[model samples]
Target: MKNITFCDQYGQLGGGQQVLLELVKAALENRFTVQVLIPEGPCADKLETLGVEVRRISNCALTQGKKSVLDVMRFAMYNLSVFFNNFSVLRSADLIYVNGNRLLPVAFFAQRILGKEAACHIHLNHGKLEKKLFRIFLRQRRTSAIVVPSAFIQRELVHFDTAFDSPKVRIVENGLDARFTSTAFEDRFSSRPLRHVGIVGRVSPEKGQDVLPALARRFPDMDFHVMGDAAFSSADFYATLRRDSPANVHFHGWVEDLPQKVREIGLQICLVPSRCPESTPGHSFEAAPLVPMQMAALSCLVMVRRLGALEDIAKSLQLISFDSDEELIPMIESLRVQPAGEPLALCENSHKLAVSRYSHNSFHENLKGLLRALIPV
Candidate 1:
């Protein structure tokens, strides 16, 4: 099969992009010819490094950010550029994998013009209106399926538009590369004493870093280490976090060696304290597989705020759950006092659940089946 995956540059190398890359890599491994359409950045470089063809497309202005005259000019230029460039590729693709929210219109137009299969894979939780209109606009077109990472998102889509009862809708929970988890699970601890609690992914308001100071003050004995960069849109928010933060909080700008960083800090726990509800959080979404199974992998207990997909993943993994700091206090204290819990077998069970359900191999098989159904032999 010949495929084209669409994405934006805003997220750069964000989690959604990582998930897109995983699918593309799998497609290549399965001997399916693939091309990726995206705004140029680090992700393009990474994809190129992996031997996948990359095509830079101009983004519509209104779709990108806040409205202004400058944005309007840029939008006009972007649309013109995209309209002309997309011609050759859209005519060539057997399938167009739409990865971003705004890229829907382009993919819709492409499929209508070329009579190819289009798949809309929603990454985050979308609002009511967005979901309602998207279903109405794309359902009867060349769209073969609508995919989401969690059941919460699937429910949200159907809630917005009851017409989504069609068999075309699918829930493919995000998966992790099993090999990556293996590396982390084996090096969970070292000779050094555990001193810090680690939080991974981009630092933004939605991520709940604003509440970090409060969490830090409550737990003075342990350090809070944030492992990611600030979004350009949320730079001021990140600045406030840095300026007002206490000495106990350490912000490591950006690190490529995530598993090694977890090893170096001898991190005993990974806390995901998100303030807002995520549609499908990539950091926690993808990490869910590792949290449960990699006991020998990381010896770390995962703590998450009771919101979005984390709630589902935590329940599935059988990990401990807490909603507020008051509740979290006891949970953290319990872990501090006891080193003995259930056997590593429990962790292994969680691992098996994660790998079997969310592994890349499983995702590839599922996607291939969907593609074949969309474009009949």
Candidate 2:
């Protein structure tokens, strides 16, 4: 049996972590001896429950530009510890799959020693330094491929490193769960005042969810709901937002049954307001978001920041896209005044397009192909 080990830096259930679950699930289904190295948290528990061997590695939270000598030594020592801890399992595996850009260095070190087949599955945006490092690692020994979920990200990476060719990079779009595919489209306009607009995902500064309160204050008629909590970071960000949130705005931490929760909360419009790359390319929020696209597939008149990853999908589905808070308010006003039929039709069309674009079968096939390329059958 081919032993494939997947490493995820974070332990919580976020978009990237969710994709890792799907990847692990696919490997199990294909009869591969799958192992996962992750921070001991909910994700590891879930993997353990599913009978996958999970090795817990303590997470070294990003030391955002702490340049002091002592701080740098601590960061380096922490990484070295993580590397040493996982080195044995990593060496034994036929293939090591690294998830996210930051964790690349860890796997790179292992590959250097073992020269084992390795590939990276990227789900978030990388900056100049990360891009430079990724290129450096990509060209190193035992590095086989780079899997990205969108053409936009592929372009961003290749453009970031012009000398690096595209042949090794694999484009694997995130797929919609089959359970959510058949669900009916939402009729957002039916509400007399057009209530219950929502933003869902792991709450973070980058996600731009704090803007929900200001939005709720602007449109008193709308009951704006923020339906996710801080995953990696502290709850302080969320606690502050909740304490200060206007009456119309609500914060519901991590919904279990997402589709049912969206329906129960009467969430008519879904918002993707992440603000990392300010204007040009879409941020990681657009990097195959699970919540927003599922809402789109369910026909919720999904609105995305025109600059984010979801913009291309929104445009393809002919759904609405907004750049700023100024642009968003007017669109919300239009939903309040416009007849329900127009948006309902658009939601249905978007759902149809999304179902075709992201499907379980395709994602499974793509993941299998990526793995096979590393360790041939």
Candidate 3:
């Protein structure tokens, strides 16, 4: 069996980390010797429970969202220390799988020095500096694959840098686990009129959880549920959201079984108000967010902002999408007043689309095929 060493920048169970866990499980199932090098946190703990080897590493201290010159310098110094400390682990592995961009530079360096093959999974859109850095490192000969979760991200990368247009780039859409797909269709929608809305994900500036308070204020009769906690340096933002939220808005911090909880609350609509700055080509903050799909899989109507891969998902799933808060307000009003049958039909169709197109089995098989191809005969 070929030994694959996976490198992740963070140990938290974010969207990218969720993808990593699925990939690790796939590798183990396929009889590959899998090991993960990540900071000590929930993700590392999860990997250990899966019977995979986990090695603790230093966490990145750089601030989230935007980084200053000092932050970049400090992060570079940290990366140097990480590289020196983990050189032997990476050198001994047949392939280096980088789960996020923070570890790309180190993986590229290892590929050049040790002649090891490398695959990078790009989960988010990057700023100008990050795009430039990715272009420089990904052009190396030893890089085997550049994986993207959506065609939207693939287009954005190639649009920014033509070098990404090469054959090495692969689009592997994210998927929902089998449990979600197997959920009973009849148990999804409630018989009563749907009035509650939900905004799920990390409460960060980019996630635009702050937008929910205003939305809640608009619809006083309806309750808005926020199902997530502040993570990845967004604690202040979460505090602000709580302080500014209206009386109708409720905050449930980090529900472990989000799908079941969402169902229990009987949330009919999930609003994804992801921010996409004009300065960036695509939605740099959110590329292929799984929350929308997860809600869709649970037979909930997902309304999203017309930005980045969200638009792609919306189009594919036939869900409602709005360009701004102004459009969203009227959309929510319409949903609140519309007949139950209409919304239920939309939810049913979206669930079907999600299950058929983005199941965990397909995700595992595709990822396994990609990795197996990298192994020699």
Candidate 4:
């Protein structure tokens, strides 16, 4: 079999990017001769440092500068670049993996253009317009399979395109490193304040961070920390959250060692209040539910809005949930009375789910099985 190749837009630290990187790392470790193509710069540099073969593409104009006609032109140019870049890689690979529905255009085009076996992983769930556009995108391709992170997404894809079935659409749960299951949370840091409630993800409007101010006012005694850098969609919204917040609301910009930091600060609980149907680039509910399990590995409790795929995971893991602030308030307040016990067992079980069900290992295995049925033996 030809080795697999992975492609993503950038190395910006987030769930989708994180999953791709982790999978890339694991693929390399498994001696699969893995290669990752990324829009050039720091992300490419980081991957090179990790000893993975990196192909830096000049496509994708991502900058702190404001948007303009030239920027749009540049973005279009990058899409062309993405097409050619992946087109070149397709020739040498047995399988191509594309993360996120946004990049489906490039992968789908490659498969149709080059007759390569490519997989488009759907990491986000959408409503109407998004579903329509995605279905249109999928219709254009006569390629490989469609991978979804949750059954929620699987159902949504089928709704948009009724022909979606086992060969095309498959479900994979988001996975966590099993080692995180053994990492312990320590309370040695004095900087760790009481009732520290953290919300992590790109600081954006869709995340529904605007409610933090009201939440802070509701529970002045507890500290609310928002950890994530802003994307264009949510930058202004994030500014408003900062401008109109109480002292209890704190913002920590992107940190490289996030999982470690979450452990260091004794992140007793993590909250994700997403306004969208609960999505971040990769996996369901922005894959924040995994945080609770990671925290559960360390015995930290996760209290999240009953959004996205989290509702299912929360029910499976028995994590906490609330509808409105009225109900959410009491749950937050109750945490002040007690911190959760060691959640190692729950964390281990959750990690196992990631590997057995969500990891690329499982994804590829399913892909192989599907191909066997689709192609002549």
Q: Which candidate leads the pack in TM-score?
A: 3
Q: Rate the local accuracy (lDDT) of all candidates.
A: 0.63, 0.76, 0.82, 0.61
lDDT of 4 by residue, 196-262 (tens): 6787777876666776898899888877888777842456767788999999998888766667777
Candidate 4 regions exceeding 4 Å error are 40-43, 58-77, 85-87, 127-142, 184-194, 231-233, 277-289, 337-377
Candidate 2 per-residue lDDT, tens place, 269-377, comes to 8888777634334335456566656888777878877654667777766778777777777787777778778878888888888777776677777777667667776
lDDT of 3 by residue, 97-162 (tens): 999888776787787788988888889887777888778767888888888889888888888988
Lowest summed lDDT across 10 adjacent residues in model 2 is found at 277-286
Q: Which 10 residues in a row give candidate 3 its minimum summed lDDT?
A: 276-285
Clashing pairs in 4: 299-343
Q: TM-score for every candidate vs. truth?
A: 0.83, 0.92, 0.95, 0.77
After the best TM-score superposition of candidate 2, give how far the Cα of residue 16 lies from its true spot, in angstroms: 0.5
Global CA lDDT computed for model 3? 0.82
Model 4: C-alpha RMSD to truth? 5.4
Off by over 4 Å in 2: 64-75, 186-188, 191-193, 277-285
Clashes of 1: 6
Off-target runs (Cα >4 Å) in candidate 1 are: 1-5, 8-11, 58-81, 184-194, 277-298, 340-357, 375-377
> Comparing candidate 1 with candidate 2, which one achieves the higher TM-score?
2
Ranking by TM-score: 3, 2, 1, 4
Alpha-carbon RMSD, candidate 3? 1.8
All predictions: root-mean-square deviation over Cα? 4.4, 2.5, 1.8, 5.4
